[model samples]
Target chain A: MTKQLRPLMIGVVGDSAAGKTTLTRGIAQILGGDATVVCLDDYHRYDRKERKELGITALSPECNYIDIMEQHVNLLRLGQPILKPVYNHSTGTLDRPEYVAPGKLVIVEGLLSLHTPALQRCFDVTIYLDPDERLRRRWKVARDTHKRGYKPEEVLAAIERRMPDSERYIWPQKKAADLIVRFWPPYGYFDENVDNRHLNVRIFQRHTLPRPDLTAVLDHSHNGRRDAISLEKDVWSGGQPVDILDIDGTISREKAAELEQVIWEQLHFSDQLHPELLGAFSEGARERHSDPLALTQLLIVYYLLTVRKHRPVEIT
Target chain B: MTKQLRPLMIGVVGDSAAGKTTLTRGIAQILGGDATVVCLDDYHRYDRKERKELGITALSPECNYIDIMEQHVNLLRLGQPILKPVYNHSTGTLDRPEYVAPGKLVIVEGLLSLHTPALQRCFDVTIYLDPDERLRRRWKVARDTHKRGYKPEEVLAAIERRMPDSERYIWPQKKAADLIVRFWPPYGYFDENVDNRHLNVRIFQRHTLPRPDLTAVLDHSHNGRRDAISLEKDVWSGGQPVDILDIDGTISREKAAELEQVIWEQLHFSDQLHPELLGAFSEGARERHSDPLALTQLLIVYYLLTVRKHRPVEIT
Candidate 1:
């Protein structure tokens, strides 16, 4: 925050249950207390019951105070404070607003972070979670039931209801993203598979923003099989050429740590950050780690830090 | 708004019972639907009960979220909306927050509008209300007892407790004001006099910002006695020389209307605004209008519109 620098802003946008929170939580853990993670649910224009009565899905820009969202992000970029609105998830009501002052890093994660050009201008780098549709549905059901107290059938119904708005207002933002993160289950795996933790992670680094050089680690890493962490040229779903870093879910933590080491060297702040704190997920009451997820977070961090090297505080 | 102009910002600041709300309301009414009057109590960090238990008065910057106030003002100046905190004065509790989008004129009235350099930068023009201490004390007792459910002695005690902070944090802001407005009863009148409405109004034009050319009307007008509306140059208590516009409350509505006509001619928007709507005040359930108040509001509008003439759409 010193040295006359505006906080680095990173946007994480995705459809519901696309692992946005998990990714954001890991990034926050790595960035530690200096990162202020803003969840966009706080901008909801209608509480749950109101939305149901109005028959408006939350994914619609009309269902949130999008203008206020733009204003809050712009204020955060100026290193100013904001009295942010809060939308309660468990109770499906609007909670008391909270005052948040921007820290060294501002990570805005939500369903429609890139819904408008004004919002897009606030970020130094943007990541869009485009997880496999089936896997996302499963995650949504699991999350709603476990955390939000929604029945599985109700969660499914909500997903179905949200599909149109999600497609219209949320998915198109992937084209505007600097990086696209997609997690997918392995072949022949069903939704209830216990090995769902082994879902493979793929990160598409578009040329819109700078990214870490993972090709070096992939070609020569002293860990598991070279294929465990690999980079391949690919055409993005958005019709752009991109470099996709593939992290196998079967990859060992040692392999993931080795990959992270490369990014840590680029970051130059590894000692202050604990790599072990990354990729933390919960299995019922117990906690588990996903190496693929850990590597994905490391790549995102590396990309975030790269922005500093490319442009140091040209923020208005 | 369609012309891509940033809203005009006029800051009205004063200590408790200096008539900030009355002045602000008159200005808002004159500006019609295009004015947004933001009361400063929304930024109170502690509710009334909390301030009592903590033995902290609201005049201290520490007792309020001054930084958030600065942030919200800056946002409003940018014509962006804010989820503003609401401190319920009647109940002395923090109520539900409200979303406020700026209209053409954003009139911020508060106890500490000019308290900080950042807050000072948000205004196009700033006003400080500086009624005589005894008169102000009477106003405070009356308002608290009538509107906030406080007994007369209890209100007086609270005022006594707040005096130190008021002197420390509130009064000094007068130095930053563009216009210093003071309302005082005529000679020999006590607090309970029915002729309190005949108080003289003095507005000190500090030349910190552009003001309407009021001297033209004072020197020659079509109504009242020669000295009913007069201008005098005086040395400010802060040591600066200022031109004070004095308005005799005893001046008839015809005299006030003549003065308002001069400002209206300068404003060029008289066709859309009704002078009759100005100076509205509530005495119990009855509405009353003070000619002195009406003339004051007209002068404020004249100063506000003059800003557009001096610097148009240069807001950053």
Candidate 2:
């Protein structure tokens, strides 16, 4: 079994407006050619019209992905292959079959990604995105009108209907993460001009402490009580909650340098000339603190820290 | 809006393993005289194997119920109704051209009953069942073996695979409910001889708070916040956690003599001859609660509680 050990798994979770996909894409860029991105949205249980007939609105956790998460995690753990579902954000439709193979880093990203314990067990690291409510709303408006073909009013209505399920399933997942990234305006915060077109990204939580090897942590079989629910328990991570930096989104480019320096120094690995990573961070350099690139860097660090600290114990 | 009031809406929710249909049958026995029980399980997005091939599960909140819930709720809310999809639990198949009109009470029950807020908002009450895990397992085992023609090992494996989704989608629902009834035993509490034949009799969660008038609740238009989650929150019911009760398989023919008197005093109605109210507290008394009376009574009370609380806000 030791002959073919896998690298690790990581999860990025958030609501639709929470910028989970963007955050994941940027992280994948930083991880370079070695990482693979798997979106959980493809597992939706129904299409639009069917969902309408059923009298439901929005993609609540219960509406879909829960079971898919289970299956995907199993496939990932076994290092077996799977034909991942492909989804279209622009059309709000799922595409034909697609598959994914293991890579140096397997990043699972989507709504409710960390919601299940079994799925969570598959992750070496976990990250949550908590964007400013207003910014997120604005993003939704733009995305819905332009991409989803929904009017502003329709989008607003859709959002309202989703709140109950979000509270019931999505938001609570934040409490279980190794890192919680909150996007906020930097110094003289909120002074930055609002750009309805560009959504600002921020890293609210960056775990500075050394992360344990998650594989080792999850290796121990769960002999624990099945129904035991503990708010303070480490869950799959099996350690204290990691302390992380909560960065502001409105910081100046110079401030971004400082943030980047801190992150690089912590890893003790000098940043290399990976054009993709550099490009991702620089694309929104003006607001590097909040751009997708900076957010990605924060997430990558979170994943590395977790993998390094917690090692899954080998079981017979 | 005031001129077009609709019937009260009630939703029944439980996990696949939980005896939702059996519980629904009990409620139907009591309210069937004047109300209609609609089975939402019929609108499954896909069958068992189809769902598995797609790497999804039936319990997903994102199942095809969105459209079904929307259509059904609209009809009931608008004072116009139609037939609902009927799922044959025995055959594990769906039958079309089946629906229930809006009667005095519209009792909608199924796996994702409370999954969607839009659907949930249309209901006057919402109920969830949380039976003993072992009982659920055994019931599923038997059903799969005899009904679905699966071996015990296969059922066990299926159950194992489904747990993640169950925890993510179903268990969290218990917290959202107003009443949570846990069944346990020293055995002699409700009946001297515990009967394992039908685990269906257990009542796990019952929401008993009085609800607003159905029409009045549905009259209020709901427009969710922009960029909010796909989950609904406006119609949430607030109350303490559920209280657990121990009831054996056998119900006593005896009533706490004072219990009847207490119920009469609370209701302030002296109608012993009224069969409906008589069954509320008397063992083997209410025509609906007879034979399997105790279990039926448990379900009726649960059904009543939900209707009272959710009062529909407005018809679409």
Candidate 3:
């Protein structure tokens, strides 16, 4: 018997508040099996205490970029057979070292991946995200103060210190990118008078190298899943409507069982899903709950097959 | 007479340890009249003292990036600038603010400028400095330990803390760069085996953009000016070698006066000694220097022109 290894590497780069992590997770979910996400923010040369005592901001190149870039690139280039530094974002310190072996796909998202030439060369494909400044700032303001425990003033000062270095070193990498994704907040969600806008995933290399349209792929994968709805127009009173399967007593057990089988057949399968699919469906159901509609659809399908009960989605 | 206005906005981005100020001053010297250099570093929401107390790394976006970015971008975009933050890299604090109007070129360099899409769009051109990791680390260790009053462990720690943020937010911008510059240490002189390697400028840019070729431009501009050579390539080393032109000597007063005419004729148009032109030459010379080249070049240039009774480069 021969063991075949398929190695995959993905690089995501964007501004501080540009939703690189959110974007990374979306991709990981789409390609879900076993996924490990590593963020480069954990490798700061100084701790919060050290930065305060020394009246220095971490904007200059004098920070610990060399080690971070070196370690990340080395591991990535070596096919992910390594231990990576894990810093707790909440505490702003290093945590346990995590081991990441070569897998189907490895997604690395950070600011400086492309900053160093050696590191930039390690990626199979590179993505740079450009989001609206106002939206990003709002997101950053919220994330920093609420999630990261930073004061508004503190966040601002650090941004100032970092501006010059960022402009000089980082923004120029956009030209080298395979794709530049620009994100705007959902249009017309703010007010009825406002125009509804769609987020654009601009493929710069469209003429050169085109990947399958992510939205199309998502649509196909999500189609007939019993609960998913294509987000079209925003209703002020409520969000997008979802389909709920009614399990009725009038339906026979055999018909109900057949309905479950049909729903399961429509769902996408990962390589790791077991041959006996019920257990996999349960685990997948938990994840789909993160998106309400996904969970609702699965629940509706399960009701139709297991219990002949005609009931609407329970609000709770 | 009509007032000519060609708004110049210069954007500079580099990694935390990359040499930004050293590069900024290179352009400042050329445009010396009423020139102001503004650092976005001072706008950091947290001063060095506060960040250490909070025990949070200053480089993370959780700190004050939104305000700094908004203010800096607003000022530059509006052409109604402020006293930009003054972050003393040697002493980490916001000591004073200096007013900067839009110059022939307004150079803004820092880490997060590229991270912020709005800020990135504001720049006409962008640059990324790709320095050797080993060299940058050495610089960091030395600067953080000696000047910034950070212990080796502290410096290393701070760098580690900021690594993820830098990678996630900082490094990706390198792919969007208009110009990517990699510096190499100058080669050995006559003795090939003798490694007289000192840092030298090695610029890299895309074929689509106009290359910033400072050497060729300076060479042509240096004509008729005094020439000085370094004995050991210590650019700041004085008493190296100087060439002085002789047209006026100890002769009759009238004859000596005629020699001034001869000297002026040889160098035609005394108006050519405009401070702006000389300033450009000095700026170019300063950039070409490695460690002490600028200091040494000034010493040599000053000695030959003033003390040695040779042709002086006058400012009109």
Candidate 2, residues B1-316, lDDT tens digits: the string is 3543367666777777565655555444444355677777666656566676788877776655555456556566555544344445565554333324566567777767677567766666566766667756766776677656789999999889988998897777665554444333333333534344222233333324553122321222122331100112132346533333233333333432222233333331123213243233211222233323343343344445444344544443
Q: Model 1, A1-316: lDDT tens per residue?
A: 3456788899989999888888888888776668899988689888889999998887778889998899889888878777888887777877657778888889999988998999999999999999889888888887878877889999999888878888899889998898888888776775466475688878888888766666666764544444776778888565788987777777776666777776677685767875656888875567888878877888778777778778887544
TM-score of the first chain alone, every candidate: 0.92, 0.73, 0.59
RMSD of each: 2.8, 21.6, 19.4
Superposed model 2: Cα runs more than 4 Å off: A1-4, A89-94, A186-192, A195-244, A248-250, A258-262, A265-275, A278-296, A302-306, A309-316, B1-316
lDDT-wise, the better of 1 and 3 is 1
What are the TM-scores, per candidate, against the unseen true structure? 0.92, 0.41, 0.34
What DockQ class does candidate 3 belong to? incorrect
Among all windows of ten consecutive residues in candidate 2 chain A, which has the lowest summed lDDT? Answer: A226-235
Instruction: Give the alpha carbon lDDT tens digit for every residue of A57-134 in model 2.
Output: 545665574654676565665565454555555655654434467675678887778888888777767788787776
lDDT of 1 at B133: 84
Tens digits of per-residue lDDT, candidate 3, A1-316, equal: 3443334456677778776765555444433444456666555556556666775544434544444455555454444444344555666554434445655556777776566666666665666767666656655765688767888788777667777776775687775565555544444443322221222222233222223222332243232333122222222223522221122222233433444444445444423322222212111113211222222223222222222122122211
Give DockQ: model 2: 0.01
Give me the displacement of residue A294 in model 3, in angstroms: 12
Deviation from native of the Cα of residue B152 in model 3, angstroms: 36
